[model samples]
Target: MNKIFFDNWESILRTLVITVLAYIALIAMLHTSGKRTLSKMNAFDFVITIALGSAFATVTLNKDVALADGALVFLLLIGLQYSITWLSVRYKPVKKLITSRPSLLLYKGEVLNDVLKKQRITIEEIYVAARKKGIGSLADIDAMILETAGEITVIANLTDDDSQTLQNVAKK
Candidate 1:
């Protein structure tokens, strides 16, 4: 009976350690990537994330690295992310260096030809976004800006749903 009880206890402890280590590893990996990295996962990001998930899960499930060792590495990564975030926030130059500014897509309903060429955006995309709001012509737009996030913002001449949204931002 004593042997059986000890075996059960050992199994439970091992399971608990694996669970904790798995979570810590995943969280640490995500935290280290920064907010910008998660904005959009391209093909490269999808492949890397899958590969890493497999390796980390195996390391924890197989008990290759001791629970403490995995946890330590995870915590160290988290700490490094925290340090970088703090430094980036405190330093203006660093903040500007990392954060991208919004791109001016159009001014007074006229597309900035130079910006369109620089951003590699085709005229077709501009027409599609305008058409989404029942706008057949770009002349109806006052200003349109594209955020660094690749999101399009259309400032229309009238208060449609799209214009209402932009007006809400101003009202606030």
Candidate 2:
């Protein structure tokens, strides 16, 4: 047992380094991903998160390391995540930088062509989001955003008559 502990020191240290790096990477990634990732946890999101966690675990603790090394990595990741969470809450600039706010998908009764191109999203995708929200035509949509995590958000500027029609469809 004692011999085993000494034999695996390098493996243990490597795992520590890898795990710290991985945790920081994840924190930065999630922070930049925006609130939609947290608020909108669908099936795809769940599966992807699980798969990523498994991969990160493997990268942090290869079989060369003992069980203790893996455990230490896990603990360090948790600690780093906690600290980052606290920091994000305490600092406004950090929160703004980390959490991307919603951008107008459409504004002033027009599809913002520049914004769509900036996101590298196709018009069809925005149209699809409008359709999901019961809009039939792009002409009716005023603004829309392809969220940071690839969720499409639609904004419609409707006249009183149009609002009544949409409200009817939305109720159904």
Candidate 3:
């Protein structure tokens, strides 16, 4: 019980040194891995971000995990992320497997109820998104999209041009 509150000066010093080195290694690895390593673009990216944090915490608090081991773990994760992202960019199947397609929640002033239910989104949430976009009326909303990043994008019904922006969006 006493050890829980105060381990010793050596342990404290070890933790301090390890923490600083681990932090520097993490930052350097992240910088080397590029922006995609820390992106919240999709669920896979989110998972990687969470895993990195967990590894960092383990390195910081767990004496069993050496600084070198933590650095290696960071490298492994970042390298995997980089490789997967690279492959995903070149291969359609890989991209499809790792990422989700955006869903159209509203179209031409009509609410896609089935999509809303399937996506576990409520009409009230859509309304709030529209309001955030400064939309005064539902009739003014041309489309509402549930993006892969879990963001609600409200499009105004001001244009008549047949834009290809919704070409890849899932209508159902």
Candidate 4:
């Protein structure tokens, strides 16, 4: 129907204006928040990012939501995220609560089945990570870690000191 496909000119113009302003506001906010705003997102950061996107959409499309309201929401979320990250850096307990710990998936060419199962990571995922890192065989890998942000880190040809640096993650 025409009603389903197109809104009136006023509605369209309102959307156009709101969209431009909201987009500019989002860019300004991201710039103000620092590099961490776009850094690797963990669970909590992911939620905040999603919320910001949804708020922006609401401000753009919904007639009842004002640009000022949406901007305030964005500011509130960004502030909270920054505060948590700041506190987590100085406090071990806060860090543990806010972020996932790095986990070891493979050690010394051995696929750690127990860790994979516990972490709900599959062998195929490990294989895919290895392939992405250009690893043709497991034997060539010294360690495979599932980082806190859910990215796999492939450590190969590690010297004793290099391996020691990863010992903390060996236990999940």
Q: Order of candidates by TM-score, top first?
A: 3, 4, 2, 1
Best by lDDT: 3
lDDT of 1 by residue, 19-45 (tens): 776787667666666774344543333
Error of 1 at 171 (Å): 24
lDDT tens digits, residues 76-159, model 3? 998998999999999999999999999999888889999999999998999899889988787788889999999998888636
Cα-based lDDT at residue 64, candidate 4? 98
Q: What's the lDDT of the predicted structure labeled candidate 3?
A: 0.90
In terms of lDDT, model 2 sits at: 0.61
Tens digits of lDDT, candidate 4, 13-33: 999999999999988988999
Over 4 Å off, model 2: 1-61, 157-172
Model 4 clash pairs? Answer: none
lDDT of 4: 0.89
Model 4 root-mean-square deviation: 1.7
Which regions of candidate 4 are displaced past 4 Å? Answer: 161-164, 170-172
- Alpha carbon lDDT of residue 112, candidate 3? 94
> Residue pairs in steric clash, candidate 2?
105-143, 105-144, 105-145, 106-142, 106-143, 106-144
Better of 3 and 4 by TM-score: 3
| Candidate No. with top TM-score | 3
Clashes of 4: 0
Compared with the true structure, all predictions reach lDDT values of 0.64, 0.61, 0.90, 0.89
Q: For model 1, where is the 10-residue window of minimal lDDT?
A: 163-172
